[model samples]
Target: MITKEALERVRGWFAGRLPEDWRAAPADITVDREEITVRLTIPDVDLPADTAEAEADEARAGRAKAFREETREQRMKIAQEAQHRYERKVSWGVSVGGREELWTHVSAPVMTRLRQPQRLVLDTLVEAGVARSRSEALAWCVRLVGQHEDEWLGELREAMGHVADVRRKGPAA
Candidate 1:
């Protein structure tokens, strides 16, 4: 887990490094052990309010793609510098109007040990065609839990941060 101060520093660095015109608002930064994801809210395209939903979506996607292509070189340069400084891969994404698109990002592999019961659960998911393999099954399970228990998870994370703060204030070993 990243310390609160460290995460703040990471956010501050990106806030300072990013071009002011690239985002309509401050970037949303998420940092983890493996990577940092920066999501910017870009300007929306102008269109008639009566436009069809499909057409509106298409326009938003086109805008996102154009932004990605236009800023690719500069984004790569920033990502390289950030990755070198932070020792973590950096990913980029943009939200235009109501549509969000993520560019190429790292998908790190995770290794885990599970008992027979856990293995059986993953196998069941694979058999049901919910996932292609145990790894996918595990990821699906995690996503489900995250979606269903987001509030609880958020509270738990907050508690964990408090614990970290308390630990830091304790006497030196």
Candidate 2:
């Protein structure tokens, strides 16, 4: 499990390395065991007041795409350095005009053994066409749980963080 202090260090490192002009504010960094995701919010594109909603959206998407292309090399370099230092894959994303796009993110396969009941639930989702396969169904279920129980999960994570801190302060084994 990643400690709060380690997460903060990752955030601080990105904050120092990222160019000020690249993001309107500091990057939003999230780290898990396998990867670190860095999301930067760029300045909104300027459009005519009379621009149609669809046109405005297209413009925003274009801006995001252009930024992605323009900064590809720099982003790659930074990601390489971060991956080496953190020993995890690095994913990049950009948010522009209320839209967010993630590119080059890792999709790691997870292995688990499910009991009959759990397997049935996943099969039901596949039969209903909610997901294409057992893996997809399981992922869908996990995402649903995350969305619905976000607050509870957040509190649980905080408690776990506190526990980790206490353990760290205890004598070494």
RMSD for each of the candidates? 1.3, 1.4
- What residue pairs clash in candidate 2, if any at all? none
Give per-model TM-scores.
0.93, 0.93
The global C-alpha lDDT for each of the candidates, from Candidate 1 onward, is: 0.94, 0.94
* Cα shift from native, residue 169, model 2 (Å): 0.1
- Model 1 C-alpha RMSD vs. true structure (Å) is 1.3
Q: Tell me the spans in candidate 2 whose CA falls farther than 4 Å from its real position.
A: none
Local accuracy of candidate 2 as per-residue lDDT tens digits, 97-163: 8988999888989999999999999999999999999999999999999999999999999999999
Q: Which ten residues in a row have the lowest lDDT in candidate 2?
A: 99-108
lDDT of 1: 0.94
Model 1: ten consecutive residues of lowest lDDT: 98-107
